[model samples]
Target chain A: MTALAESRRRPWILRRRTRRIVPVAILAAVFVFPFAVMLFTAFKTPGDVFSTPPALLPREWTLDNFAEAFDQIPFWRYLANTLFVSGMSVLGTIVSCPLVAYATAKVRWRGARPLLGAVLLTMMLPPQVTLIPVFLIWNGLGAVGTYLPLIVPAFLGTPFLIFMIRQFMVSVPDELIEAARIDGASEFRTYAQIVLPIARPAIVTAAVFQFVWSWTDFLNPLIYLGDPDQYTLSIGLYSFFGENDVAWGPLMAACVMFTLPAVAIFLVGQRFFIGGVSAGALK
Target chain B: MRMTTIRRRRALTGLAFAAPFLMGFAIFIAYPIGASAFYSFTDFNLFQSPDWVGLQNYERLAQDSSFWKALANTFVLTATGVPLSIGIGIAGAHLLNLPVRGQPLFRALVYLPTIVPVVVGGYLWRWMLNSQYGFINYFLGLLGITGPGWLVQPEWTKPAIVLMTLWTVGGTMIIYLAALKDVPGELYEAAEIDGAGPFSRFLHITWPTISPVTLFQVIVNVIAWLQIFTQPYLLAQTRLNNASSGPGESMLTYAMYLFQNAFSFLKMGYASAMAWILFLLTLAVTLVILIGSRRWVHDGAR
Candidate 1:
């Protein structure tokens, strides 16, 4: 009887162990393996990159690919361009979205509900539907190839960010606003001083999201930024792919460079990143 | 009169606060939508004046084989990709929820891919899926399995795109993880006390609790997949100047085709028509999902 029980318990133990190991292994392999391959390829020599049986690790890891990528593309210029665009976008979103959110969330006005509804409706409308007219308008204004088309809209407030900030603002106690009013605070002053401070988390979430969106935006830049000098990293990378189609090592290295800032931002602001995603979905 | 003036003052303050966004919405969103709808009915190539042509663009779309093919491709992608992604997301969330030592690290690792610009991710996958030199086939070869030329073959291209898109399932997975955290532990404890197995407990308790989240994810994923462009576009449109579709036009998604019409072919009117159609289709799908969800989605209140 003891032997039988021990034998049964052994399978259960093994099963539990396998269960623990299997999921973690699969997660690592699926989620982490491609990145490892990318990093390895970035450092690999050109010869190793296209080798018949591709070595996961480089036979000779070198910085030549990164050097080559830099030489081939105006990496620093594009990085600066991306930073400028993203910075402007983040500032625009943070400034405009919170005010709109405040009005919709805190202020009792007849148009507030309708405006909120419109915001939600706009979120569902395909960007393509608006593509032609917006592009045409920008073209008419001669804002194409400039950063105006990209940066200006961000200042107007994005529906999603507005919705998110509004959700956060709705939970702010009315007493605080009342107290601010009693303290002789103007409406704008109450917002700038009291509401803004309390809504820092949501604002941070919006800033991070807008920064990432602007940094990674392909379609907008692809459409508007015709000047190579004005090119962001995304478009620069695409152009690099075009010119150096067969140069896998340098291409991967360029990709690694392009991806690093976003990854760093994500890692640093991971809590906000996770929080923003949930809020967008659940709210 | 005093109360009325105060109400008016509050209203003005509210409008002032919302003015920037309201103006932007009017100019960027509302105006554009209206203009696109009008343009859909008119023949407005960039160089020419828009000729009012009622239903001609839509009529042309009806007979356009490429438009139909693009529609079919988009449908197949959304039909298959959304469910598969949600399944992967849920499973990934469950795995992360396991009593593991480095859960946060694992979660972060999973989310890392999503932050990578879509362009970078697309190129990375293109390199990885290269039949001859790609590590994917190289790894598969270890098990003596020959992988198909993913980008070269029409039959395999969509599936390859699906695989590439799934790389960013981390976003959805994170959402599911948040939902999983909200599941009460007592219910699981009760299930365990009743000798319910893990799978049984999940089916009975965990799934119902998270069904609302699943519904939300499904709609979001469906909309995303319907508008799928960048992955397939990068995979197929490698040449900077070339506007041709990839390998039997297998990777010509609806949005890609619409883009070609608008930008490449300069069929602005036709593309506008396609956009309107896409809008209607998205609304229909979302409505169906929202309406259909009532049967299965369990509100915790119930």
Candidate 2:
């Protein structure tokens, strides 16, 4: 086995491994030190934050910044709004993208290839190219300043998610779909029962991505959500930054809160996140 | 006749499956693209209907100093940022591929920054890059070196943005890491038998193996940098009352300027023109990269 071979070769490899530790440590520090600093700063008092020589560890750790962050803004309201938008977006993306992906990847029809090409073309098109006209259209419909502008597009099936899901669906064996068809399954029934179960991983990947994207999306919300009542966490954070530019403690605390859900999602879905990205790029 | 009915039924079913995306594409993508093109040639604001003004918006863009400045600034960022990011990604990937202890933890540490929202990352960097009482300068002082006021100084602003951008290179690094896994250990063993040093072995074996991934990363990063808005927008525009570009417009990227034109100035036509230009530039760059990739990318056949 390769394990036996590797073990025999381990003496030389083991020596080289020790040499690698220094660079690995440096890289880890470079990447992680800021988050550590942010965490420490969030716990620090305002005086401790602005001390002459900045402290890596807080002199007296406190929850005052978190309390202040809440009092300074409608933090809970923005969080609820963000959750609502992101939830709707994830639901829409999962429902719609896979249906379209099935059509393009498995359905036997003359239009399927051209439809796939259109999806790829749309993926390459910049959102800015369509930004003005889309805004105008939404404005004409009186959807501006509402969550409609933000959430409605997800139902339409994003090109990137469509492409990614289609890529996954293409590799699914035709015999399985054929078996379902031979059993007199309806096209929709087959898609829902057989294909959807098989493509669960891809759907989860797409959902996680959509959730993170919607959660962190600033520009669309910035353009559409003019009312404070409709503002998501991203725009809420931006507005908070606008008001308290020098209030680093509360700002850092708010940022930590803003980032926690995304970080938690990433940690939980780390496997799918890495797999989805590599699959997207490599395919 | 029976066979024809079945074929028609299949096509109908396909259309049913595709209907949602098709409807969205027609309304959101197709119509918007056509309308944006039409709007590009018109003088329109949200207040009134558009008046046809052929090529005037493009002509104004040609002469607009701020437009030119945004274009130049974006190019500067893209030109420097893309290569620096690719370099760091490759180096980090190699470091990660080393046989070591606790590799998963190290990988996670490097990748953790990427999952953080840009809004949070931008604000965090703004604080750390603060001229006084910030950690970056303080850390530098420990080594007896003075750090500049990163966000305040015009010359340092773009580089500071680039550095912050590099912090999220973990995404690209992961892609390269995936590519590294695909490289054969036998190739390395053969090279080692031939008395090749580690650097030479990398150049001969590893470089060729990952060139395809490098091409893909380059195009993706180029498009991203071309459309960069949030990092600079958040860093420079702290207050709602002041939306001006920071410190001599150094942080004013093309996308931010386009957003400003559309929203702030209400120059819908002008912004449309800028967007079309950006689209064309993205297409041109992507084409050049694809064409140039023929020389360097090893497509596995050769």
Candidate 3:
């Protein structure tokens, strides 16, 4: 009896240990393999990159490819352009979206339901459906090839972000808003003080999402910003592929460079990242 | 009387909050959308005032071989890609939700693709699938099998895009993970107590619990797929001008066609008609799904 019980416990312990180790090992490989490959390719010579049984590490690790990547385009200029566009959009979304979300969530209004429904409807309409119209609208205003077309939409408040913040705002304790009202705080003041601070997680969440979207936004920048000098990193990368023939080594390096900022932000904000993504599922 | 005044004041304040969004909607969304509908009836090139053609563009679209080809390609992509991605997403989410150790790290790994800019992801895949010296071809060589030219061949191009899309279902997977967490634990326990197997438990307990999420993902996925542009556009534009658009037009997606007509060719009026047609297709598809969802999607929480 004692031997059987010990045997049963041993198998359970072994199974648990295997379960723990196997997933960790597999997960590490899944995340690290591509990153390792990308880093290795970034350093390789063109000859070495195209060779069979490609060197896991470059035959001669050097900064030659990185240098070439920089020379191939105005790397810093494109980076700066991307930063300006994405940064301004993130700031705009943060300022406008939360206030709009708070009103839709907490304040009583007649057109509230219809308005929210309208916003939801926007998601269903393919942005492609309005592409020509928006282009014409911007061209009429002479805002084509400028940052205004890309950045101004952020100020108007995005329907998606409005939905996210509203979902988060709905959960704020009613007493907190009531207490502020009793103290004669104006609605704007109450939102600024009580609501914004309380909704910090959702704010951080929204900022991170907006920043990523704005940074990676290839379609808008492609359509609006026609000038080579004004191109974002995304457009710059596309141009590299377009104007030049295959230069795989340098091209991968530039892609690596372009991808870094978004990855850095996501890693830093990982704790709050999944919450924002999951908001839609809950509602 | 005072309560009614308070209500009126609240209504004004609410409008005040929505003012920025409403203004943006009118200018950016509503106006442009309304304008497109009007333009669909005209013959406007970008350089001149639109001529009132009155249904000529729509009639031309019906006879346009390329338009039908693009529409068919878009449908094929959505029909294959959307369901497969959703299936992979839900499965991945369920696996991640198991009480396995290192769960957070693994969850982050699966989602790593989503954080990478789509442009970068596109280039990376382009390199990997390159016919000469690409990693994927090399792997097949090790198996004593020769790999087909993935992006270069027309028959292979759409499949290539579908493969690339599967890598980024991480966004939807995260949503599914959250929905799974909200499902009641007791339901699973009761299934275990019964003689129910894993498949049976999943069908009975898990499916019903997460059906709403499945419906939401399906609807959004179909809409997004109908607007597929970047991959096909990049693929088309990068290779040979029209060839990259789709394999001998095999990959010329409806969104790419709309984009080409609007921007590259500057056929604004024709593009507007195409956009409205797309709008109607999306609306019709969404309505079908909405009606069908009534039979499956549970609103137990509500």
What is the iRMS for every candidate structure?
1.3, 1.4, 2.4
Tens-digit lDDT track of model 1 for B1-302: 99899899999999999998989988998899999999999998888988999999999999999999999999999988998999999998888877766778888898888888988888889888999999888888998999999999899999999999999999999899889999999999999999999899989998999999999899889999999988888788666534457899888899999999999888889999999999999999999999999999998866
Q: Write the per-residue lDDT of candidate 2 for residues A98-207, one digit (tens) a residue.
A: 99999899999878999999999998899999999999999999999889988988998988999899999999999999999999998888999999999999999999
Over B174-293, each residue of candidate 3 has an lDDT whose tens digit, in order, gives 899898998899988888998789899989888888998899899889988898888777655663223257458877999888877887787889999999999899989999999999
Winner of 1 and 3 under TM-score: 1
For candidate 2, report its TM-score. 0.96
Question: How much DockQ does model 3 earn?
Answer: 0.59
Displacement of residue B116 (Cα, Å) in model 3 is 1.1
Between 1 and 2, whose DockQ is larger?
2
* Whole-model lDDT per candidate: 0.89, 0.90, 0.84
Instruction: List candidate 1 stretches off by more than 4 Å.
Output: A1-22, A242-245, B241-243
**Model 3, which residues run further than 4 Å from truth?**
A1-12, A19-33, A242-244, B1-5, B239-243, B298-302
Clashes of 3: 3
Per-residue error at B56 for model 1, in Å? 0.7
Chain A TM-score (model 3)? 0.90
lDDT of 2 by residue, B1-302 (tens): 99889888878877888888899999989999999999999999999999999999999999999999999999999999999999999999998877789988798889989888887888899888888988889988989999998888899999888988899999899899999999999999999999999899989899999999999999999999999998898889766423458899999999999999999999999999999999999999999999999999988855
Q: What's the distance in Å from true for residue A53, model 1?
A: 1.1
Best by DockQ: 2
How big is the positional error of residue B119 in model 1, measured in Å on the Cα after superposition?
0.8
Error of 2 at A114 (Å): 0.9
Docking class of 1: medium
